[model samples]
Target: MATNSIKQPLWAVVLLLPTLSSCGSMAAWWTDIGPSFVLQNASTGLLTHSLCHSNNTPLYPTDPPVAFKTKYAPKNGTSLTATGWYDTMTTWASLFYQNNNDDIVNAVYKCNFETGTYEEIESDVISDRSGTPPPNAQTGLSVALLGQQEGYRVFYHDRARALHTLKFTQVENWSYGNPISTSTNRSGLALGSMFSGVRNVTVVTPKDVANIETIRLNIDNAWHITTFPTPLRGSNVTNLSNLTSLPYDTSSPPPFSLQGWDGNPKAIGIAIDTVLTRHIFYIGTDKAVHSYAAFVTGLTESGFRAQPDQSNEYWPLADEPNSDFAIASHLGSSTIRLYYLSGGQLIEAKYKNGNWDPASRLVVANTTVFTNNTGPVEEDNGLSTGAKAGIGVGVTVGALLLITGGVAAWILRKKKSTTSDVEAHGDEGASTTAGGAMGATQPASTAQSPDVASQHAEIARTGSGLSTEKWDTDVKDMALTPPPRELESPNLASELPQGIDRNELPTKHHITELP
Candidate 1:
């Protein structure tokens, strides 16, 4: 038995050979997610992460979240939590965090898709806007990066509760922007974009008990503030701040205790489907993950899902969920991947093919760093979901076709993948977005991803716009290789670290700005 176990790991390396050789970087499933996620060890001040190695060795299967630590963590960094944005075009990852002095720090990691490695970590302390108290990031960190030439944006709050953005350009790293808006948004500061392209960097902030305000960035570089209506569930209007009980969902099993809406905004996670539907995920009082959608129509309740623990027991916000969550989707695909902390283990939940995945995959973590992806996972297609119809996932992986028969069971699992509320209390949203244009600019962003043609991706890797910074690495093409990863091992959670806390959380504050 021992000999066979040893042999199994060796065979995995053999399996990985084909996957690694043809091309690297399959957007989300491969490079997109590999850089977007950064796990941490709070006790050790170390960061654990993985490359785009989905076909990991059997000794640790489910493409185990590989353990690694970057050398750039600041000496006085407290909490050690981080958020990152992986610019697919540049293969650059800007990881942001709060240092001991409460100053914003960005540790940049340059990655190579062809080589399959995110080898080095370099960092810098972002400068303020001439005189803005150094823009201390007093709240959680969130980031959103534009593809190709547009640059990137990171959001946080200073001690004064004012929202600040740290943006990037080839001409500069992160130059602090003037304060855009201010409120009592102590937590739940998320930066995302509903459509594609370098249009609006949507900012979701808790203004107060009565409202949630969104400050958006336009192509012309001006900021626009919009107030969205409360979440609607089947004609009933209710804000997350007022709900104290679980909304009924036929998909959910009954809970243990019914009373638990502590009115706190623990965290907010957002995912976008290739179809252009956006789903926002958050934990409800009953421990179920609540989802709501945002479109031109307005905010609508999508559904809620309560995942099962190891014991198969269900509790109402009594255990598991620490409320810190991060979700991202691959461009051109419908796959939405979400990560959250449960009993110190990183719980990975996926929504794809119109259903929420029930797989109980857990990544052990002493701490975890979260990041943002522009869109969903690689879809069921040929090239990074960029190829529609018969195009192969690889711009052209003839070899991958040979292995399809070998991993048929995994593909079958993918085919079977498998939603909540209605309430209206105010204006749905902006109607000025005729075709989702970025404020009188181009039509709603045509979200860019890897398109295939003779082993090259349609999107360019190097940007002529960036002013040639020293941190920038030599340009390399991300071979539009289809991900040839294996099926997830069912026992991934068991093999990883495990534990759950029964602690109850006290509610925090929400935003309160109206149009």
Candidate 2:
């Protein structure tokens, strides 16, 4: 009987090969799920698809992502954290934090679809018990690292009492592997008084991945700024200040008189509208949410500054969100969202129509409390309700269909209708041509003008608009290609022995300003 059973499975396996092979050859699962994978690359001002959604379901409200908690968010609410999203072939949201021991911190984590968890793909600490803790380490400690181009990490070192930026690229196993990269210290950019007022960094995509820059705000001085461009040889931190009390408008200078913030701005977040200009949002120390329009003017002079508008542009004054907390925009748009944990309950808020709307407390289940040691295993798909409905309907009506094995499972689809929709959903014949000639890679255009096709191909590799040959090597390995091993030279390692010259100014160059 056992031999017969084994033989039966073998026969079934032999019969199933052709059917499975046919299905594999014709389907385009990756392209259909492309939109759900929108990744924002703050460096290049571009967005790409994520690896997680490449061959599976798209991420969205209708599809609803399954959250996989990392082994990072603590069992208790004690540590401070930082997070941001990047656009590549997919949209990936990354949250970084320090463990109570200051020595523990993962560089990057990827969201897992099958298990609905965030797993660490890289850890940055060089030594187990290294470095002095940050200022808030003893009484309170936090780890905040903003992801940037060329695998650079912008984090605050509390023990050292400074904000330092380190840029390193990882290859092979992410166990803090051999680095083939570089680093430049940016402590001066957010030094002393600067760090005093600043709380968080909000990455903005001013233009497509080519002209990406960070807008730094000194909450205490109400100062705003961006970093100097490359080949300057060191960190050239530029202070963006206009003598006028109000903020500068990206399109045109602010017109007329405006009521400015009388109190110091504390908590800050930035978002860009559909037109691609930036809008600055912050909560003043006086407990008021404020808005500003930031711009760099006097292209020939050192005159970059922020114009704080206190007109009807501000929101949630006095009565709402009066505590210290964190704010982040949702995955896709400029609409800002806020999160805070009170009494072990998580609550959220949003900015709408120039006012803040409070969201009900997020009821995280008892069994689902994401802890430090244990990660978020899987998300509840809310399938029990569907199961109940299926049972209530009974199975009698489909008995004949089940016996004939002819009932096809329903396929999920997005609502957007356009040429993109057609490409995402695929032609009716996509399922039958996966491994076939239908899905073969196409030759990129060799047109003259600005080389848009090559640009897309370059974006596909480095997740940026700026072309990178070194990053192309990293991309090839991440794509599961066999990478050639070479010796790790000291020069190839990422390090900046000499710190930055804090006083350098940015050069003036103009692109067509957004309308």
Candidate 3:
């Protein structure tokens, strides 16, 4: 009787092993999907720099060695813009600009973090195609990496108002997609306004592309954001075809509208943090910089709400503004950095602890660097907002074990009582059969342990480089801030073009434009 009681409790423990193993697997999956903070140490090095024009003195200190320099003078008519991302230990930068022949070209270069040396891939001619006219040559370009396999895709809008895309998979392999229009007319998407991050890509334009009405891409990889029909300018509704539309078929209508979209596509930029939070910066018609935050829901739904934030009048008030801006989320930290061009200088502002830090100039006016402002892109820093939540799951597992232990004790007590009754009845043979059944369950438990341990090992290996203690500390410091107060009125709406209604604009626009 005593031996039977001991055996019954052991069998109960073996049955609970699978449940414990599942808890560990859930914890690891939570960590895997979180934001990456792998490149925290790589950003300290000096970046390449040059004067915007030859005659001007260097704006930043020359002590930090320049990574690369351009011989062309800004005053002599040159156009240049740069975008970059980090791929593990390698920092990749792509520059797109108008060359001496007034044609657009793309140059790709990789920098080894350990060596700090730049290797340039042979430059590729992106413009000057057979059917493309001189006026329709590329005017602006933006590049984004779609993981390591897809390489990079470059976006631009031409003079004919058509959106064009060029993909570069390797040094010699380049492919161009057909041109697409944002409106029914020949007018296409705006120049230098398309931006992409992770799985999401957005373009800001005054009109719709093809029959698609929204400017954002959802999880379906189709143009499916719910939006009001673009305001009509004239009676003609031409059915212009978009030759460059992505190969995917669009069969479903978008479910929701792009929040805070004011129908203007000019002077806008976007960035996504490690956890997929989106920040959009734009020069409002008031000539001040305004930012909006879009919170993602599930895999496909996003709530785009206007952030109650705006910068002083730091942007130019010109019709065709030369100012541009970029955004990046600091690695391993909740800090978000905004870099913009103002008065020919590179100015930076930080958003942390729920407030925007005052803007400070980093490089003097006209100092140029090949930075798109979307910081190191490829580091899988094993830290993210979701990873921090996994700690809570660990606590819950402990509670589950406690409950399971109590159940085992109760079962043991019942078995002991049954054994005593059986001994009194002289049913020794029945007790032996029950003990054999318990022993038979042991092999299945043995088989499952190896698989469970293998899964646990894999997750541990993936997160081995990250420190859980440091990740927890960083998350606690980055608690979400409350929404900001709305801007005061007499704002950007007063400066809008004739067709736009001021009532449709946000209320209380209290912001000043920058010089």
Candidate 4:
């Protein structure tokens, strides 16, 4: 009778594997979602990463993710942005973040696609070729790689309330652009940027807190700015803070449950797809993801005004997010991924195959990558909202382990013995970033130190060191838009389908946009 009691649980465990495997297709998750995302450890405030690998799925909590401390620890609610080059032949990634002192720090890493690992190359303050770095940045900052010798640009808001740019190349080094004059003061510190072909576009919310200011670097190598009105500044919408604003009652959809905008950091997530359609994402007053798509016209002031397609339905899954978020799209790919931190959990949403997937996952936020954030992880460095969330998760996990621990232990022993170290010994070195779209990779150690080029060479190499003719509308011969196009779905509606959980309470908006 004793032997049978012990054996029964093991049989149940064997049966549960297939059920968990099919619950959500592991293959489908990777194909539709993405490869990885970057995060700031809420516990330690250091940079950490969460990724998907062939050998592992969310089903297994056995082998935890390894986190290497990447020196830049962002402020409590700072924005995080990344840009890099990735293709079959090359991969390089760079992460730009605002540190505690409000300085813009750059961390470059060499990535192995085969083993899903990041090897640090260099970490330092961004400076010009003259070895002069730019001014300290406020919370809102963004970066982009503008192809070849055109180099990369990091745009940030300064304490003086001015928008500034740091443009750099491998040979010419770094130089500061004149402070950009805005149509209005940036009442909301929301800023985001994307680069493609011959144009780079950045958008910020001016003092009005309602309209969007589009800043463009045209084919002529000059900056042109335009402001567009959005439905954001509705009568009920007011600048408040998450702490004070009326929490949104997400028991049902809007009209029935929409709340006003509180003082939440409007961290913008932006990406460009293969169709020349540029999309921007931000947290609405209701704390859901509101999306707008436009076909780039390549003109100066009205560059993004033409063919604007706004989605009527907001992605409700993106509720109550922290100020930092990201959007990433692969080179010439139709898929775009959105990521944000909510209650210390990293939520991922996807817009692909001409529709937004109503399904979003609480990704690595639940995994061991967040070991510190997954419990009452009080650390000396600092832990805020994310750490508190772990108390509940810790209790539930403990209850579950008490029931299955013996069965799990025996099974784990059997599984571990059969699982051998058979991953490829060597692979090409590329790039790593938390917020940008990255190429597919295999599992590898995060400890390897790969050979890297000189600092200048890294700047050029990270962006593929290939520059085409500058985008000139007058240049009839240059190909600015790629030829591939998606057949427009005439039946497509402007709204996204809602994904709701009846048991959970919804967030109310009370956030004020911080400059």
Instruction: Report the number of the highest-TM-score candidate.
Output: 4
As for TM-score, the candidate ahead, 1 or 2, is 1
Q: What global local distance difference test value does model 2 have?
A: 0.25
C-alpha TM-scores of all predictions: 0.52, 0.37, 0.45, 0.55
In model 2, the worst 10-residue window by lDDT is 20-29
| Residues 133-247 of candidate 2: C-alpha lDDT, one tens digit per residue | 2322411122222112233233333343222332233231112211111112221111111110012233321111111224343223221334211112223333322211112
Please give the CA lDDT of all the candidate structures.
Answer: 0.34, 0.25, 0.32, 0.39
- Report the Cα lDDT for candidate 3: 0.32
In model 3, the runs with Cα more than 4 Å from the true position are 1-59, 62-81, 86-90, 110-121, 128-138, 170-172, 180-199, 206-214, 217-266, 299-303, 310-322, 329-335, 341-345, 352-355, 363-515
The C-alpha stretches of model 1 lying farther than 4 A from their native spots are 1-36, 55-92, 111-117, 185-195, 209-211, 218-222, 226-263, 297-322, 363-515
Of 1 and 3, the candidate ranking higher by lDDT: 1
Off by over 4 Å in 2: 1-79, 82-93, 112-115, 120-149, 157-160, 171-267, 272-276, 296-322, 330-333, 340-515
After TM-score superposition, what is the CA distance of residue 21 in candidate 4 from its true location, in Å? 37
Q: After superposition, how far is residue 480 of candidate 4 from its true place, in Å?
A: 11
Writing each residue's lDDT as its tens digit, candidate 3 over 269-366 gives 55544344556565443445655555644333344545665445322232223233444443112345544445433454555435565554442211
